[model samples]
Target chain A: MLRLIGIGLNPKKHMTLEALEKINDSDEIYLELYTSRIVDMTLDELENLINRKITLLDRKTIESEFLVERSRKMKVSLLVPGDPIIATTHIGLVISSIQNNVEYEIINGISVQCVVPSILGLQNYKFGRSVSIPFPEYDYYPESVYNFVLENRKLGLHTLVFLDLRESLEMSALMGIDILLKMESMYRKDAIDKNTIIAVISKAGSEKQRAIADKIERIKERDLGPTPHIMVIIGSLHYMELEALKKLASFPENENINLL
Target chain B: MLRLIGIGLNPKKHMTLEALEKINDSDEIYLELYTSRIVDMTLDELENLINRKITLLDRKTIESEFLVERSRKMKVSLLVPGDPIIATTHIGLVISSIQNNVEYEIINGISVQCVVPSILGLQNYKFGRSVSIPFPEYDYYPESVYNFVLENRKLGLHTLVFLDLRESLEMSALMGIDILLKMESMYRKDAIDKNTIIAVISKAGSEKQRAIADKIERIKERDLGPTPHIMVIIGSLHYMELEALKKLASFPENENINLL
Candidate 1:
């Protein structure tokens, strides 16, 4: 039997009781962290809670069939960060499991997509399709994200931008802002402008989780601590939403003259 | 101190350890079921788990300062269904708490919005603005949901329609489909037609979770069973998503000629 468990944002506090029971039952447990990062959770703490040693599944090991072989022999659990069971790679593995007739279960986690908008007091219903800002490596920069924001803006819907995270390199909110600014310079479609206001959420779902809103230009230079941050481009704002940001975090709503 | 605790989808097993710990620590505990529902969880089970007397909050009492007055004195936990912290009403309460000089914390949950897409194996990024179909009263049928679906279809984005839930009424997937079909007949828009394919998810995130996909006309008469069902009007089906639905549950892919 194989279980794909969702270990939420803060591993120690956010993982559900059901997830904990599954972790305790599994004979072999593996944590996949390449897709996301847990800022507050340590392996020692998780080990103490589950009372079992967890093997880290890196890019190389994940490519191997150690997990599949173990599933055939014994009960195995693959822990993914922030509700990744639906991810393409995980879906492929599940399909493989079904073809091989290996039973499996998906324990849903507290997805970051759900938490970020909520934490910032933005109505989740108003959000359009979310986009990811990939690290511009090897002179390759995808302007698709700008197009997404443009499409969302056209409909007066908010866009949630997830920063890309590579091996040992987590993109910060500032970096993501820089990329968007650069994309704006290239496209010049008026999707991203200096006068436009955006929300930068840092260390989301952690104790240090913070939401800051300001003009695009000012927010681009702000250093928002440890990585795995999310940036939200505001297409339209309700009065209560702006007030929520003002009350909950540092939002320079008054400074953004282009909001109108 | 105040804690907006997220008691997840299934009351029996979905809530996190952190939520339980906070519930134990708080002097007052309240469960707000107005926003969402836990299908299989009983009040007894929840109260037994936390070992505290749980108070229920409805719309009438939620508007009062009863919670605020209590929070000013001792630690309180407003246990919300799914994730209530981001909820507008909950945010209003939190704002009042801050004004009253009360410290609060937001504990996230396994939101249905996130899990439905995950369980259906649809990429989370493909979803556009979510729509809610209010239970139409006498001569109050709203066609806003059709507009949402129309807009999403324009961008080839999936529309997640949340069926409205009232105290005495729990809108089922069948009812939501009926409303949409009624709208299509009234508006004569091509957005929702007999040929449109949709995915119906019943009791999502629970042990008895079920997902089915078929044409609109076929699904309208299909009895999905129980309340609190989510309907997804698929835009562009990715190969992996269609495959996941084909493999996981009863999805009549071939029956829909218009799917091509």
Candidate 2:
């Protein structure tokens, strides 16, 4: 039997009792580190907390079905940071299990996508399409994500921008800002100026997680002190949202508050 | 000082150690049931678990400035089910606190909006606008939700339909199916066939929570015990998503597997 367990978004304590039990019961534990990571705990920290030696699986092992096929003969727990099914790639593993006639179970955990919005005081329902902004490759950054944010704003909806992070490197919020600045340039010549409300959230689901909302330019200058950040672009704001931004995010005076 | 404490989607165990510590430290704990609820535990259960009595706050107390002003003078912890800020109304509260010069802190928790999609194996990024389907108002059901689903489908996105539950009422998956059938009828003339792929998720974030995927017609006929349910109308499926649905959701094979 194959088990897909969610290690949750942040640290070892974020895991539920049931998830912990499953990890202990499994003969072999494999962790996929590509899609997401626990900022509060390293693999060594997790190993010490769970008291089990876990083998780390790279993207190739996850995508190529190398471990999944072997799981049919052994009770293996595939640990994914956050909820296992949030990423499309993990869903692929479940599908391969079905094709290989392997029975499996999914253990749920907190997802950063959900935690980010909640931390930033954005209503989950009011959000439009969520897009991932990939890093610039060979002097090229895609405009599709920028266009998506632009269209969502036209419709008076908020946009959640996910930043790309390499598997081997620590995740950072700077990548998210970089993507936003690129998107802001597409908006207008003065797009990166202080009027826009952008929230940078890091280490979501962890106790020490931070969410800061401010003008895009100001955010660029602040030291967020972390990786794995998500940026939110607020198109239109309700009176309350504006107040939260002003108080928590330090919204500057003279900025348009008549958005509602 | 005002404290926004998230009680989480389930009852007491769902609350993190940090949240529990804050609640214990507060002079007054007020429970706000209007925004969301705890499915796994009741008020008495929560009280017993926390070893403290909590004052219940209605929508009026939250909306008006009475609670906001009162909180300024005392160490008040306003308890909200799920995360504190996923709802626009909660953000409004934060704004109000700021306007009144009330120092406040937000203690985040697991939200169903995020937990549901993670359990259902749906891509969080591919979801469009989320809408709540209120219980049929005097047999006059609104078709706007159906139209939303249709539009999301056209965009190849998923729709998360939150089934409405009255205060003090127990919610179940059957009510969710009823709403879906009503929605299905608006799209087609027939008595809402059951073969459409729909997921019935109940007690999300709880240990014994349940999730099943089948045709809407079949789902309606089957008995899903208990309240706090959500229906997902899946549109275009990626290869991995389709596989996860079949394995995890138990989706029927007749549905198209490949995207053009």
Candidate 3:
């Protein structure tokens, strides 16, 4: 049996009761932090909390058939940072398990998509397609990120921008903002500008989580204080939503930030 | 102090350890089932599980300043069915807490948005703005539902359609599909038809959860079993996503369902 469990955003406190029970029942447990980093708790602390030894698996190992094959013989569990299948590769494992006739169960966990919008006081129904901002290489810049934001904004829908996590190094909010600026420079679509209102959230769902909404220029100067940051591009906001943003996220007063 | 705790989809088992601990420490605990229903466990079972008497609050009470006012004098907790702020009125409470000078903390939980896409083998990032299908009144036909689906489909993004719940009555998959079909008739748009492919899920995050993907006609015939049904309008599919849908969600073979 293969048990795929989501540990949520906070490694220490966000795990569901069923997820904890399943981890305790598993014969062997493995975790992967490469997909998304959890800074609140160390691996040793996680192992101690669950009272089980954990084997850290790399992307190669996870994508490979080792875990599935091992589960065919004995129970194996994979502890994911968020809801199990947020990463497409986890769904690949589900399909593989079916093909190999390995019984598998999914225990849901709190996900960034579920938590961030609520924390920022944005209605979940108003969010558009979420996009991931990647670290630009010397010659690589994906236009899809800009296109997604443009499309969502065109329809008066908010966009959730996921900062990239590559090889244990997380893309910071500053880096993400810079990438959007670069995208704006290249596209010249007026989709994003320094005057545009945006939100930057760091360490979401943790005690130290910070959320602030302001203009791009002002946000770039503030110290968000950590890695694993996510961004939200503001769109048309309902009056109640605007009020909530001001109260919960420190969004600038209406006189300071203009939507129309 | 006020704590907005998310009990997730299943009332009995979907709570996080932190949520459980906070509830135990609270001076009083409250739960509201009108926003959403939990079929896996009864109210009595939930009280027994938490070892506390729960005062059930109505929509009016939740929307009012009653909880915030109560929390000003004591530690009060509102046990939400899913993630707390998914319901916009909860954010109203958060703002009320701020206005009343009451401290509040949100403990995230598993949400249908986080779990349904994964269960259907759809990528979370590919989902567009989610829409809720209301229990249409005699003269109430929401064109926004059609427009949202149309916009999302045009972008080749999947749409998560929430089924309506009114006065402790839940909207079934059949009702949602009929509503969509009626909208299609009124709009005469090709966005939805009897042969359009879609996914219907019921009792998500529970032991008896069921997921199935097929044509609208076939899905309409399926008894998704119980309340809290969610629908997903299919969009462009990645090859791996299509495969996973087939293997995990019982999506029909590609030859049987035509995308173009």
TM-score of chain B of 1: 0.93
lDDT of 1 by residue, B44-132 (tens): 98888778899888887887888888888799898987877646788788778877888888788778886887778788888999988
TM-score-sorted candidate list, best first? 3, 1, 2
Which runs in model 1 stand beyond 4 Å of their true positions?
A63-65, A221-223, A256-260, B221-223, B253-260
Measured by lDDT, the strongest candidate is 3
lDDT tens digits by residue: candidate 2, B1-260: 88887766875445655577778888888898877778767788889878889888888778888667878778888888877877777777777777777888777666776677667677787888787877676876777666666656666677777777677764465766676676676666432355456777766767667777776656666555456666777666776667666666667767754452
Model 3 lDDT tens row, A1-260: 99999998886778888888898889999999877766578899898989889999999999999999999988899999988888878988998998899999888888889888788888898999989887787857788889999999889899998888888678888888888888889988888877777888888867788888877888877777687788899888877778777887777665454443
Clashes of 2: 11
The reply for model 2, stretches above 4 Å from the true place, is: A24-27, A64-75, A100-103, A168-196, A202-210, A214-226, B24-30, B51-57, B61-76, B136-150, B169-197, B203-208, B214-226, B257-260
Model 3 gets an lDDT of 0.84
B148-189, model 3: which lDDT tens digit per residue?
Answer: 998998898989988888886888888888888888889987
TM-score, candidate 1, is 0.95
Q: Candidate 1 lDDT, tens digit per residue, A109-157? A: 8878878777788889889999989988896768777888888988778
